[model samples]
Target: MLGLLTSIMRVFEIPMAFLQRILGIKHLAWVFLAPNLILFFLFAFLPVFLNVVYALTGGDQILLRDRAFVGADNFAVLASCDNYLDPNTCQKDLFWRAVHNTGWFIVLQVGFMIGFSLLTALVLNRDIRARGFFRSVFFFPVLLSPVVVALIWKWILQRHGLMNAGLDAIGLEPVLWMLEREWTFFWSVFLSIWAHMGFYTLILLAGLQAIPRDVYEAALMDAATPFRTFYRITLPLLMPTMLVVMVLALIKGVQTFDEVYAFSGGGPGSATTLLIQYVYETGFAGAPRLFGLASAASIMLALVLVVLTGLQLWATRKNADG
Candidate 1:
C-alpha cells in the first residue's frame, strides 16, 4: 500500500506542479496582497508621515513654502495656555475643549449605542413574530445618509416642531432641545446613538444567529437554565464578533463629525463640538486658517484612536484565547 501510494504521488507530481506554476499560486501571496499594500502606503502611511511633518513645522504653510522649522512649538502651544498668535491670554483654547468634548462624546455615545444594539439584537434574534419586519425597522436608520438624518432631526427637535407638538398634545411645554449647551450635547449624543445603533444591531444579530444550536441543546441536556445556556454557550461563541463590532464602533465614534456638523455646527457655545469638527473649523472656517494647528490636532486624534483600538483588540484577543 505504501509503495502504491508513493507511485501515485510520483505520477501526480508533474501535473500538480504544472498546475500550481500555471496558476502562479506559489507567488499568490504577493499577487493577492500587493494592491492592498500599495493602497495602504499611499492613503494611510504617507498621509500620516505628512501630517507629522506638518505638525512639527510653523507659520501655517503646509506646503513648506517660506515655512520655518519650529520644532515642538506647536505641541508646546497646545499643551500650554499660551497662544503664540494672540497677545492676550486665552483661558481655554480650541485644542483642550475639542479633546474634552470628544472624550465625553465617545464615552456616552459608544456606551449607549453598543448597549442598545445588544438589547435589540437579542430581541430580534429570538423566535418572535414579525421578526423580519422588526429587524428591517431597526436597521433602516443605517441606510439613511448622516446629513439627511441630522437635518430631519434638526427639523423635528426645533422648538415648534414635531417633538414639541407631541409634548403639547400631552399638555407639556416645549423644551429647547438644541438651544442650550447641555441639551445640545445631549441631543447630539442621542442622534449619534440613533443613527449608529442599527449597524451594530445587525452585526450582533448575525453573530447571535451563527451560534450553533447543538451547543444550547447540550447545555439543556446538562440541565442548564436559559440564562446559563446563554452565558456559557452563546456569549463565549459570540466573543469574536463582539470584539469586531466594538472596535468598529469605537473607531466610528471617535471620528464622529457629520451629524454634529450638520445639526448644531458645534454651536450653543461649542457644546457639541468634536475633534474632527474643530479640525475643520480651524483649517477652513476662519478667514486666515491655521492649517498647522489643525493638522496637529488631526494627528493627535488619529494617535488617540490608534491607541484605544489597539488596547481593545489586545484585550479581546486575550479573552478569546482564554
Candidate 2:
C-alpha cells in the first residue's frame, strides 16, 4: 500500500507542483476574490451584523454611548400587541398593523401586476401591426421615477384632478378618490399596478422573444391548438423568466414605501401604511425616537423578506424539476 501510494504521488506530483508555480495558485485565488470580499464585508455583512446588535440594545437612541444590551426585550415588545412605549393606545403599535397591511398589499398588488404584465407581454409578442410602437408605448411608464409616478397619480386621483374632471365633464359628481378610505386604498392599488406592470411586461416580452420559433411550428404541425401550444411549450419555457419576474415583483411589493407614502401618506386611517414606512415613522417622526424598537422591526421585516424569497425560489425550482 505504501509503495503504491508513493508511485501515485510521484505520477501526479510534478504536474501539481508546476501548476502551483505557474499559476501562483495561493495568491491567484485571493487576487480573484479580494475585491468582492472587501465589498461584501463593507456593504453587506457589516451593516447586517450591526443591525442585529442594534436590535438587541435598549433605548430610543442609536449612538454608541446611549446603546446598552437588553437582549430580546425589544423583539418581545414588538411581538406583543401592546405598545412598547405607550400602554393606552393600540393604534400606536404600528408593527402588527404594518405587517398585516404590507402582506395584504403584496398579495393584491403583486397578483394584479404579474397577471396584467403577462397578458400585455402576450399581446405585444404577437405579430400585430405597429407592434414595436405599441410595446414602446406600454413600457414608457417604467422609465419614470417612483416618486414622480406617485405624484402624477395623486393629481389624477385627487378630487379636482383629471379623473374627477373627466367625470364632471361627463356631467357627473367629482368623487373623492383619495379622501375616502376605500377609494383611497383602491386607487393606491391601481396606481401601484399601473406603474409597475410596464417593467414586468418588458421583461416577459424579452423572454417571449427568446423562445425558439421552431418549437411553436413543431407544436402547430403536431395539431396543437394555440392554447395547448402555449400551455405545453410557451409556459414551460417561460417558467424561468416568470419565476424571475415573480420574485422581483414580490420583493418590490413587500418593500414598497415611497409610492404609498407619497400618494396618501398612508392616510384615511393608515390604509396604506407599509412596514418600511412604519419603521421610518417610528424611528424618525415622533419625539423620543424608539431606535431599538425600530431596529427590531426592521430586522423582522428583513427576515420576512428573506424567508419569502427563499420559499419562492425553492417552490419555483421544485416546479421546474418536476
Candidate 3:
C-alpha cells in the first residue's frame, strides 16, 4: 500500500512539475482549479446549454440534429391563452392549470412554513424540559426521504388507514383524504410543511441563539413585556434569517413535485398537480414526448429560480449595507 501510494504521488508530481515549468508559479492556481472548472462546465453549463438548444427547436424527435429549428414557437404555445385568469381557456390548458395550482401551493405552503417554523423556533429556543429531545423529534421528519414521508402520510391519512381508524374508534366519520380535490391539496400542503419545517426552525433557532444575551437582559430591565420584546428586539434581529427561510421556502414551494406526486400522484382530477409535474409529464410521461415544450417550461422555471435568487442576494446585500 505504501509503495503504491508513493508511485501515485510521484505520478501526480511529474505533471505538476511540468505544468509549473510551462506556466510558472503565478498561474499555478489555474492548474489546480482546471479539473474542477472542467467538471463544472461539463455537468452544469453543458446541460443548461442543451436545454436552451432544445427549447429553441421543435421536436417529436429526441436528438438535436433531427429536431427542426422552430425559434420561439414552444414558448408562444405556453403563452397562448384567451383569458390569463382562466387557465381552462389556454391552448396548453393543463400547463396553465399547473401554474395556477403551483401559485396557490406556494402561497399556502410558504405561509404555513414561516408561521409554524417561527413558532417552533420560539418555543424551542427557551429553557424547556427535554429541549434536545424536542428539537430532535421536530428535525427527524426532515431526515426522512421525501418519498417515504409522503408514503407514510398517505397510509396514515387514507380512509382505511390509521387516521380514519382512530376517527372510527372515536365515533367520527371517515374523511376521504386522497379522493377529493380540496382534501388532496390540503394534505399536500400539510405534508410538505410537516416534512420540511424542521430545517427552517433550525435556521430560526440558530438566529435566536446568536442574539446577544445582554439585549434581552436590558429589555427585561426596562420591564418590556414578552410581546413587546419580541416585536421590538427579536423580530428585527431575526429578519435576515427569516428572509433566508422565506427565499428557500419559496424556491422549494415552486419546485415541489416529488412529495405531492408521491402523496396523491397529482390526482383527484389534477387539482394537486404543480408546474414541475406538468413539465415531467410533458417531457417523459407522454406517448409522443413534447421535449421542446418541456424544455420551454424548464426555461421558465429556471427564470423564476434565477429571479428569486437574485432577489435574495439583493435583499441580503441591502441587509448587510444597513
Per-model TM-score, in order, reads 0.81, 0.83, 0.96
The model with the greater TM-score, 1 or 3, is 3
lDDT tens readout by residue for model 1, 273-295? 88899889887886467777777
Against the true structure, candidate 3 reaches a TM-score of: 0.96
Cα lDDT, all candidates: 0.83, 0.84, 0.94
Model 2 residue 55 distance off true place after TM-score fit, in angstroms: 0.8
Error of 1 at 252 (Å): 0.9
The prediction achieving the highest TM-score against the true structure is 3
Ranking by TM-score: 3, 2, 1
Clashes of each: 0, 0, 0
lDDT of 3 at 158: 91
- Tens digits of per-residue lDDT for model 2, 192-223: 89888988999899999999999998888999
Q: What value does the lDDT take at residue 89 in candidate 2? A: 42
> For residues 1-322, what per-residue lDDT tens digits would candidate 3 score against the true structure?
9999999999999889999999999999997899999999999999999999999998689988999999999999999999988998999998998998999999999999999999999999999999999999999999999999999999999979999999999999999988889989999999999999999999999989989999999999999999999999999999988998899899889999999999998888889999999999999998699899999999999999999998789778876876
Models sorted by lDDT, best on top: 3, 2, 1
